[model samples]
Target chain A: MVSHKPVIFVVEPFGGSIRWHNPSLPLIYWDDYAVTRGDGIFESILIRDGHAANLERHAQRFCTSAAALGLPEPILNSWINATQAAIEEFGEGEGKCTWTYSRGRASTGIPTAWVSIQPISDVVLAQREEGVRVMLSERGWSFPSELPAKTLNYAATMATLRLARERGFDDVIFTDPDDGHVLEGATSTVVTVKGDKLRTPYDDTILPGTTQAALFAHAESQGYRCKQKVIDVDYLLAADSVWLVSSTRVAARVRRLGEDKLKAPDNENEIRSLIDAAMTRG
Target chain B: MVSHKPVIFVVEPFGGSIRWHNPSLPLIYWDDYAVTRGDGIFESILIRDGHAANLERHAQRFCTSAAALGLPEPILNSWINATQAAIEEFGEGEGKCTWTYSRGRASTGIPTAWVSIQPISDVVLAQREEGVRVMLSERGWSFPSELPAKTLNYAATMATLRLARERGFDDVIFTDPDDGHVLEGATSTVVTVKGDKLRTPYDDTILPGTTQAALFAHAESQGYRCKQKVIDVDYLLAADSVWLVSSTRVAARVRRLGEDKLKAPDNENEIRSLIDAAMTRG
Candidate 1:
């Protein structure tokens, strides 16, 4: 069940040289206090045909998120080059690479950054093919501003995912407690087609999925209606089609939620074309 | 500004030889990955007259918190003895020691186990004598049950402290968003005297402060009324005296909050005596 061609790459601190733990294994610096403390920021990107998909947007967001956490920005071009070198070293492939930047190690009690790349899991592709079952889980996020940027404090999200798995669901959907607005999935942005409009939660509460943003932009350019708005559970249940979007998964449709089953979209081909377009964007 | 004599100690991880990078500096394995990733637990204990204060309770909570995080308990007695040896090696009077256990490094993802011990800062003694000002900050904690145990994920608490310091305060008091219940300080317990009754926030929303709990038990035996219940900002403002309790500070009165200045407690001698008795487990 390999998702794509196999590839291996090294993760280095933002501006550092690529080294390996062993001559054969890529050296990733996990010695930093940040990785344990979750005191860093990261972005997941897709590499297809040796090009990083949505690299600029991912880098910009990563920088912004890092700034919010008071971390120095990793040299984006160096990271890109390092990632490219790793990808080339592993040979050509359709896979995922995660770029993580922590605060550099100093006496200042911040984190030192590191990055790692691995082959995308086959289960992601399988879910893309078969769609997925999701459960609504309380992540306890009350304010959008509090969670605007990505931080390493992800234990709550992990707990939600664990609970979702225990409950026999493939993924979890989080909501804002103040107004019960459907926020996003644990690791993905939520998008749904209601009648003729594609809608997503409008706020900084969740990570803005690069794939979802690009897909929505492409959808709008192609004369498909798209919008960002507060989505309630009732609105989600009545949506024509539900999709979870991320860098790796692209666009995974929601097959069943709780006891209610959903029908596949009539515009499934168009949605895939939008995903393909997103993947091709630099 | 050094108000107390220094006693220092170092501890090695269970089953590991005491390694030192330099003869004077003990090399302790700290899973920075575990600490930054919030994949570890830690305990701070007061060392007085060459003995760790509340050795049994501190060791127990350290094990309990680690267990809650799915980590196996390290050799508690060995670690304790190692600490004592370090203190003996360094000599002792009044100082603080921290024992931290993290899930060690993982091949990938997160770690499974690691530990370290180090001496506390000297500034803690200064704060004890001069008193400290605290600022009220909102943590927006809506879900209490999910975060019952202490983890390395302390970014929010750190942020609150930074915010407080930026506004000219030494510490911050966090409150619940749902009902405006005063929870506790970012790193200490909140205790205030309202008339003859000593009150603290209930134990559910915050970590059970060892020093604060012991003080309450000792206060009750000394004929001071003690109560643990939900307290709001208004109650805190109206208290006869407000103090923050922790391992290092033991107990320090809050002199001012925002624009409101509080008078030093009339029962200062009695309160200090109670705190001393509690520290001695009388």
Candidate 2:
């Protein structure tokens, strides 16, 4: 009933091959932890112009995530092959190439090894240019750093974003519960620029945003000093310019941090190009 | 090919009706949040001697969780009715009545209102009597209390349990990274008794466990002083007697908390009775 239907690719065992999924059919079992308990790990890579950027990094993260969740070693090549197959069929479009390991069904040790390619909507892309309105809300405690993992637990973040939308913000910014330090965005990373310095939170309490890392690496190559450190809310507010970075969002300048207006960096376009360059790097 | 397969029941909205599902067939949509992102809320109630015990409590918790997740208000009656139908089909056997309200597919805003019944195998039930050995591990930071909501993020807890299992422990106990205080278990609650006091972690950092609440109520009725407070690791290790309580496992005494052996509570049978009474209470 909708235009541009999503193309799904599910991974099978050794001899099993991935295929296009029928949208109307049920794809997961009744008891897979991915469904019942959200007991799985996933990755979403941007597929731009038929290329899934940073797939290897994503693959490595997926393996690390699998080990973190105590699952069997992920068949990385199988996933890359399957995702590439889907992307090839989806040729030359902007979409997210996603994969998940849901720990599968509880009954027979069902494995949730699957991948799909879904279009990135125009509305989300608009945030990349128009910039995003952000609000700093108390995120209490986050999913702790001792665990550098993202399980299927998007409920709290979804709820937070929903609340933020209702209150007229594009996205929400999470702060440390104990110290009110800037942690990260629900689906993005926090980066700030002051003079020639580019800084972001290095603590493990947040997802070590790959897109943010790419931008920083590119920035360092360009002679901008880049460092990872804890950023307090006050420090964030007082920064010269702030931006939220991620794979999908790429680099979005924060127009406002709470009630304060953030001055745009003189090198906004230049910084963005660096981030874009890293996003597509192999 | 399986003996004693689980019987599943599903709920539907307008133009939809509740029904039983084949154990071997697919039950979740590929796009449903439950499958794709594990974005949903769920509850599992114990069915003993033909009754879905404490369903009202579970219903209330479900509603609370829905609110916490900022989803639409749940149609609690429909859930109760659906569970009744599943229980009727299963007849007299120990099983869990499970219900989930996944945000559903990202497109169409389709609501995933479903229910299922799965039998509790003998091996799992044995933990209630034989007790469980638990190890303390750092959970870094948890989804903080300001939210008091659980999203589908089960990644860290699953990883911690997996590590503990590899080390031969039945379950893993989480300690706060900052201060090493006891937090809740992956799927259960923590409670202890020392002298005349019944104590459990009162912090909002952990789930407000319903079963644990009932135990406290029953304990208070028996004239024991009940309290909720931060339980440090040392305090838990030194506890007179500790137990991890939940709806399914009921009350499992901590045979060993870390390397310290907790002498059985002089009142093991007494504590069990309290837990049992709460398990079936409406």
Candidate 3:
């Protein structure tokens, strides 16, 4: 199922529009602005067969995050249309689509919306097959209100990721400094499978990932026990299997955590089955 | 000096260069792009007599902040030339000039630079004479490294300021959550006169205000003792005089804090004298 590499398409809703400026400059510039300033909120959705997977859930999350940040309501229909346009422009591809909105520019110091589109890199697809080795890092210093929203202030996460990458790790798992409880990954949500029971962190400190939520629902329907509870790093290391879920990478198994190599089932078919279930729902 | 309202001018480095497909729309509509995402850093300078006050310091701080966030450096000479061009385009005035840079329209995630100029608002100038009321709030959730860089993640400050304004205050004094020590103001540095000594918070949790540093130097030369220490909210309220210092406002007394009305001195001339001395050094 993961034979071919997925190519994700990124789109910026306010990018190509000429309502304000000449749409001559590619939306890539606007995307760069979003990335640099962390000034906006973004939602990433998996795309399969030219349709966004769990798009409504992603859109609702986007709106909720935007509202929390006091940003104006994004025109969801227009955004959907923009996403469709981007998909059509890029053609059918297996990957994710991201949409971002910022407060518009005004002297009042409010942000306006901006958007962009990009293709997923090959390395992201490679992680699905080879799995990932992650290290627990104490970073993600954020307020409660800010945790759930995908705001652009990802400097801390970026710093941690850079450190993790330099230390020969694919990703970093953030833990609460107060008690050493696992929070989430820098760009993805964490799910640990102990036998049939799956547990995730229950807090606003991490994004409520669309893919994770869908997987939870599917797991429940399949009579698999799922719980959202605060789990310490010890529990995570002790878990039988740990998976990181995001819009782009559905569920990548954690093979090695720190120095401890955990026993993961060689059930690639089961993992692919879970992803297929999500794709069907998509 | 406070008898008449001051005039302001707004300039953009990309003013003529900004290509707009829709001329009827406001320039702000174009801002909906990445610049608003706070993916950039900015510096605000007070321009007096056709010259930017503390131009070097402002430029250096701007560069430092940008570098901290991994943004590409703005060409200093080009920036100076562009700023001069902007000022020349806007002519001379007693208002403030703000230079904002976003990672420009480059494909790189790092910000290039975007510059905009605007006149200082009358309300900001009004506070110079009328003084400002402040309320204390918590800014404990942020990390120390993030505190040093003036990235666009100002949501916390903005929220505090909004609450302060709603409560009939000019701005907020952020306090440490652990011990309730006063950190700094939302837009300015907090300084208090206790006996003949001037004191402010000493920590990387606040932007090292250039104006505050200058004030310390001027105060020392004027035979006033200068100290940097952890100050509690209670101590701030009990100080002999408390002032909010920034480049544009120079110095403004805190007339009220929470429920307590301060007996602050209306020695605007003396404060201006010190500010003028510091500006001369710039």
Q: What digit string (tens of lDDT, one per residue) describes model 1 on residues A141-239?
A: 443255355666665565567677888889988877667788898789999886668899876656677888888777777777988888888888898
Off by over 4 Å in 2: A1-3, A13-16, A194-197, A220-224, A233-240, A263-267, B1-3, B13-17, B177-180, B193-198, B218-240, B265-267
Residue B282, candidate 2: alpha-carbon lDDT: 42
TM-score of 1: 0.82
Task: Identify the superior model by DockQ, candidate 2 or candidate 3.
Answer: 2
What is the DockQ score of candidate 2, to 2 decimals?
A: 0.63
Tens-digit lDDT string for candidate 2 (A91-153)? 677887788777888877957778888778776789888788898887865674555665677
lDDT of 3 by residue, B95-143 (tens): 4666556544323343344443456677877888778888877775665
Q: Estimated TM-score per prediction?
A: 0.82, 0.90, 0.83
> Over the stretch B106-214, how does candidate 1's per-residue lDDT look in tens digits?
3343333322223455567677777788898777644336645566666656556767888899888888766778988878899998767999998475778888878
Better of 1 and 3 by TM-score: 3
